[model samples]
Target chain A: MKFKIAILGTGNVAWHLAPALEEAGHTITEVYGRSEKNIKGITQKLYTAESKTDLDFTESIAEIFIIAVSDDAISEISDEIILPEDSILLHTSGSVSIEALGYSSATYTGIFYPLQSFSKDREISFGEVPFLLESEDQTTLQKLKKLAKSLSHLQYVVKSKDRKALHVAAVFASNFSNHMIRLSEEIMARQGLDFEMLKPLIIETLSKSLELGAKKAQTGPAKREDLNTLEAHHQFLNYNEQIAEIYRLISQDIIDSI
Target chain B: MKFKIAILGTGNVAWHLAPALEEAGHTITEVYGRSEKNIKGITQKLYTAESKTDLDFTESIAEIFIIAVSDDAISEISDEIILPEDSILLHTSGSVSIEALGYSSATYTGIFYPLQSFSKDREISFGEVPFLLESEDQTTLQKLKKLAKSLSHLQYVVKSKDRKALHVAAVFASNFSNHMIRLSEEIMARQGLDFEMLKPLIIETLSKSLELGAKKAQTGPAKREDLNTLEAHHQFLNYNEQIAEIYRLISQDIIDSI
Candidate 1:
């Protein structure tokens, strides 16, 4: 049951996923990256098999080729990487179309997108994250689904279009939410208040979304249309015009949407 | 010790705090609100306590008065209400100055601001929230601190100005974060994705923040300045001009700040 895997990128996803896949009892046949230093460091600690910065990627060594490159590099990486005609090729992009692999020689190509944000230093438990798998053929889809299931507790065989949709959703959920937290920190710093103080409230707000749906769990001046409190906060943001403008626009949007 | 408490105003704060105080072994002698229905509801809940909607709100009340009215109403309510000269009057407001309560007949005045957002239907555990205590006098401050300690595990002796700062911080952490989730839902809806799919990412993003600070935990196109991915997402948002604008502005802000 130990299938061979090759990770073709040394970015955050590859850094996190390679170790996790190895620990889950799979064989990483080869690892490749552009930076020699990065390739050397990852290979030294992680690559018991093979590591290379050159474009001599061969499909004969591994049954699955995971192109974990950036969105821009994924198509080119897939196009250039030498893979076996029968071997399955997958990209870990949320937004990129699975059909981007259509030009490749591999008979089976699809997406193996992990529906979570990855940080290089932080250890993300792959089992906890949902993996979205898709393939043009049923056999390949089933193979990827089983592999995903082995690696993660949550796996869904979503359509390619659905996968694209999920990717856009992840941007909003992970990317935008983090931006809001940063904004909060900036506002607190400007006011000479420790951002740590807002931790409990942040946790509670997220938990409420899980307990009650986001629509029902919504609170604050925007939701309540508390014009007085809104005015007060706007005045308080006098020093930061950009943030104040953001506050007004977002609040108005929320109010108008509701 | 069973401190006598009178809750002025039957708003969301009073609805939550009064019950929490009673649960913590304090005796609520009276509940006051401008609406008869609100007064009646609280009176029915606490049978022994007097509930009155009229202007005569000072008779037969406890030694401690908690003003849980709106920020604009705090000064007006304090001015209208007469209390025992020795009674300690406190307003449960984060932004309003402590001087708002000085207009009351009570010689002792302070603030008992609980640093949490409350809704009428939701039952919040007071023990988990940090109560920010402030007073003009040392004796009243000490008394309010003691009261806060009895009801909550975490208590901070925050000054009025600091409390206002904290309020703005809470807006970012709580209000803005909720809006972010809402935006994510809207984005997913437009993309034909179920909003529930983003729940895991939402929970993980928040839980990660608890361990790694938001700045260090940041990720996505904005963080990396991945123009290809950014352009793709922007193209994806062609139909939704409002959200696309928001996405562009926030992403630009994050990139600029970083």
Candidate 2:
């Protein structure tokens, strides 16, 4: 099931995916990127992959070409890359659709979106990371399933619309949650309090919520419907109108949910 | 350093704190609650404590009494409880002030607020849980510090105003973060997707944010300024205006923070 693979774009997705693919027994035949620095960055991780700074992949032995670039660049790069005939072409994006590839040079075009946030500095295991897989045809989908299973046990065949919903869900689950901590950090800074003091509470609350399910794990003045504490908090935060608005809306949401 | 203690409430805080204090070498002399079931529930966890369903503590020999009730009940219960003279009285509330005790029967009044979300079903170690300690007098503050140090390493002598700020910050960090996950769960349900699929992403994102600090760990369409993805997500969420409003406010906050 191991196929020769060529990864395009050396961004966060490509930086992580290329090494993970190689580690999963896939042979990385080539690493291509417009930036020489990024190409060198990814090529250093592979044992036998050659680096290419151009879109030329006509002579590539890669059976699967993965374009792990930005959404805007995906279509442009898909139209430009000259993959071998009958090869499977994939792009790793949560928002972009399979149709965006649109009858490319490759016989099959698909999406290989990893439903997790990736930072180049943090090392992550793909074992539990969900990979949303889709293809233009059934045969290409089976190939993707094989590849995805090798890296992670969690793989789903989602359509473009569902994939888009998942993307928005990720925004809430990952990005919005992180920003909540940022807002807390700002509040702490205003009090001359160290952000470290809130770390244990943050970690425990999130862990407990995940364990007991978020709906069951909701706590605080909002969930308790304590008007005195809620009023006191609002009065304290009245100096910052934006933060106060957020507090009011989100607290109302929690109360309404309850 | 060990002292005799009486807990006046059989709530989540009392359930966790009584056992933690007992394990730290303190003697739980008495447990009090209006509900016999709750009194029995907490008394079972202690070796030497007697359960009381009445407010009769005039003859009690305990050196320290803790009011681990709701914020509204704190003042009423503190006033009604006829504790022995010269005993230290404490209330475990993040928002309530020490002055609320207002020269009660006990010679010393203080706040022993453990800044964490506690549940009766969960077993939480107090070692890392920060205890925000405050008292009416310098002498009582020192005693509160000693008691806090015995239970946890992270004990802070925060004034009432700073503690109020911390409480609001906690609402954002713990409660708001959990709600974000709840919102994500709702979004997943709308798409007929399993909420479990987003668990890995949720855990990893929060962990990364904690490790690198939230500002550096932020990643999403908003952070990237991908208007295509942002607009697509907005259109997808147009079915619900409240969620869409939340989406807009949080995303704008992230963009502004960047």
Candidate 3:
């Protein structure tokens, strides 16, 4: 059965999700945000100009309402989500739990967290993103699993706690890793080094790390404990204390990890 | 003119470089190592049994002898290099300077530091690895540049001091970014999560980081300063102090970076 779904929010997640669900043959009846103008771009992609600026969502009929707003906004939005009886309400947030949607006593509530960053301008196939589905109710969980199954092959039935753990891991994998490259750019920016030059090495090392298993793939002066090279690198970073400290700590961690 | 190359060491760099150079039509006349038996495996791929267990490289007749050895071994092996008069000698080291090859009086020395981590078992196209070439003497630098240009399009003429800086930046880009993934793996491994689930996120974030510029591409609670999610993650990691500490430090750094 093709489920009728309504989408809430006009951010990155909603932008990607709206088109993805519509393309998958699900009917997205309406898109809601604080301002209809804000979600016009996303709703237009669904070939439907049905957008509403409503604090309390009324006069909407859909089997599921996906709230893809920010974590802080989720609670207030859920208060506004007065969906029909026996229908489902879900939030696409890795950090926020299913309990955040507790305002709807008449509907089944759940989580449908896609574990990847979404950008409004950048297109990503929904099928490629890992969808983490979770709920305390079996019926709601099964409903989510079925809906998620239609979108991506990479689906996981995770508990709220484990999902939280995965989210933390993700922050490390994505956020910290990106910061490391930022620092790399900062260091090279000093000597007028082109960022393009470092791209291949960054890509190669990531692939190698995955293939060899992270532990086995570890290399460099820190992994080798070449104090000579390590010292040389340290002295070079003497002008920047924060970066030097990070280098020292991470290198020490790698050594200690061994 | 095709350079006749003698590669010293049978490690990752030597193993990849020998075949890459040979395929590019340079004559790989001999493969030298501490033990001939060790290099036999590497040399067989070159369709030659020209393996030499030479403590003192006295009889090597090559236009270029590329010492792709360990940092400490570079000095000792440089002492052993008794190549033809005015022939090119180079050590493939990021940290070790051209001065390390000062032990050789009969040859003009330089540096041919390939800037990616190589695995002996994993075949890498030499053209893909950035070759950082450096030489004090003009003639030797030109000769080294010519040989390097034949193998890779990504070539840089760097000074010894600046090259060391590049090496340090590489540690952050490749090594630390890799360790971030490793930590991600460790976190997920606890809950028996499939590493494949995280691969898409890792790849997407890394690409996005490069595309948007790292500072601009950064996302997560740290970037948002979402203390609720950050505190929840911290509590989840309380049992593992080291990981928790790393998490705290890196998150703090990301927030500070903004």
Candidate 4:
């Protein structure tokens, strides 16, 4: 069940996935990164994994080459990756199609797209993270599925185009929600109010929304049509048009949703 | 030192506070509501607490009258409530001031605002919910403080204006975040995606945001300035102006904050 892996790109996904692959009994043979200093810790803990600055593999040594780079760099790096006749190549970009890797000389190509946002410093349990897979044929997909199953149970056969839509959903669920917290933090600071106290509230609100269903869990002045409190907040944020506009638009949306 | 109390309103806050007050050894002497059918559970659980539809107190009665009605109704209820010469009066409202109860015939008026959202069906531990207190005088504040201390250790002495700001902050933290999840749910529904899969990401994102500080914890294309992916999502949400507008404005705010 163990396959040799060469991870390209030392970003958050690479940092998390490399160790996960190693822990799942996969051999991390090589790691390609822009800086050797950055991959030192990764290489040291990993068994027999070496760090390199460039993708100068004349012949694919590892069974699988995972291009865990940025969206823009996926094509360039995939093009540089040289794979053997039967070896498979993959990239972790959600938006980029499998064809991005297909343009390369690799005989078999696929995607091992983990549907989770990774923080380089934060430790994420890979087993819980959903991995999306896409390949040209059933045989190639089966091979990739075995490798994916070893690392994560949550695996799906999602191609690049579908992943794009999922990626859009994720932007709202994960990214924009974080932005809301950021907005909350900024808005609280203006009134000299403490953001720390809202921690329990923020955590419970999201958990409850998910448990009870978001539409049913929605509560606020906007939801209640309480004009007084809404007007008060509007006047409070009047000085900052950006914030004020956001408040107006969001409140109106919440009202309209009902 | 337990005061005989009368609670006006059968809403979420009142439903929780009445039992909490009784459990804390305070005498729940009376419960006032718009209808008798709704408050049967509350009266049955409380000792010697009579349920009435009107707020008529001819002579000296329950030492404290708690107006736990809506913000707009607080002033009206307070105006209707008549108590003895030195009887204390309080309203459980985050936005409404202690002055809202000052129009009442009761000598001492205060606030006992629990800084937590409540659902009537949900069982919330009052001990963990922070309570905000305010009063016209030191003695009245101290009296209300003792009552607040009996239910929760997390008590803050906040005045009207400050509580308004805190209320506004609560809306952003609790209400708007739920709206974000709703937006996430709606956006996902368009492409036949399961929102249950998003539970982990939503839970972790907020917990991580609170733990690491919202600003530092922020991730995604909005934060990374990944124009292509951001543009893709913008186009994906093109038909729906509300969702698209929210996406654009928040992304711009995130970029501006950086």
Q: Best by TM-score, which number?
A: 2
lDDT of 3 by residue, A1-258 (tens): 467888988999998988888888788988888776787878778876388787445566677889988999988888866666687888999888777888764368889998888877687977888898988789889888888888888898887778878888898889999999999998899977777778888988899888888899899988999887888888889998877888888888899898
Error of 3 at A46 (Å): 1.6
Candidate 3 global CA lDDT score: 0.84
Q: Over the stretch A1-258, how does candidate 4's per-residue lDDT look in tens digits? A: 789888888888888889889889989989888888887857876888888887776554687888988888999988876666677888887778888876787888899888776787778887787788899778889988898899877878876777788777787888777877877787678778777667756766776788898888887789989998899899988888998898999999999999
> Taking chain A of candidate 2, what TM-score results?
0.96
CA lDDT of every candidate: 0.79, 0.89, 0.84, 0.82
**Which window of 10 residues has the lowest lDDT sum in candidate 1 chain A?**
A40-49
> lDDT by residue for model 2 over A1-258, one digit each (tens)?
998999988999899999999999999998888877879998998899998988878899999999899888989988888888899999999888888898578888888888888889888899988999998699999999999999999999999988889889989999998898999998999899988889999988888888988999999999989887888889888997878888888999999999
iRMS values in order, in angstroms? 1.7, 0.9, 1.1, 1.3
Candidate 2 has what TM-score?
A: 0.98
Q: Write the per-residue lDDT of candidate 1 for residues A1-258, one digit (tens) a residue.
A: 677888888888888888778877888888888877776655665647587777556535788889998887888987887776578899998878888888886778988888887776667878878888889889988888878887888887778776765666677677777777877787777767767667777877777866776677677777768887788888888887777877887888778877
Q: Which candidate number would show the highest DockQ if scored against the true structure?
A: 2
- Candidates, ranked, DockQ: 2, 3, 4, 1
| Cα misplacement distance, residue B154 of candidate 4 (Å) | 1.2
TM-score comparison, 3 vs 4, better candidate: 3
- Which lDDT tens digits does candidate 1 get at residues B1-258? 678998889888898888788888889888888878887766676747787665454566588988998877889988888776588888998878898877678788898988887777777988788888888789888888789989988888888887877777777677777777877777667666667667777777777766776777777788889887787778777787877877787788778887
Q: Which stretches of candidate 1 lie over 4 Å from their true place?
A: A35-48, A159-161, B34-48, B55-58
**Residue range B140-212, candidate 4, lDDT tens digits:** 8888888989988787888888888788778877888788888888876877777766676776777788888
| Residue A19 in candidate 3, Cα distance off native in Å | 0.9
Say what the interface RMSD of candidate 3 is.
1.1
Q: How far in Å is the alpha carbon of A129 misplaced in model 1?
A: 0.8
Candidate 3 wrong stretches, greater than 4 Å: none
TM-score of chain B of each: 0.94, 0.96, 0.94, 0.96
| Ranking of predictions according to TM-score | 2, 3, 4, 1
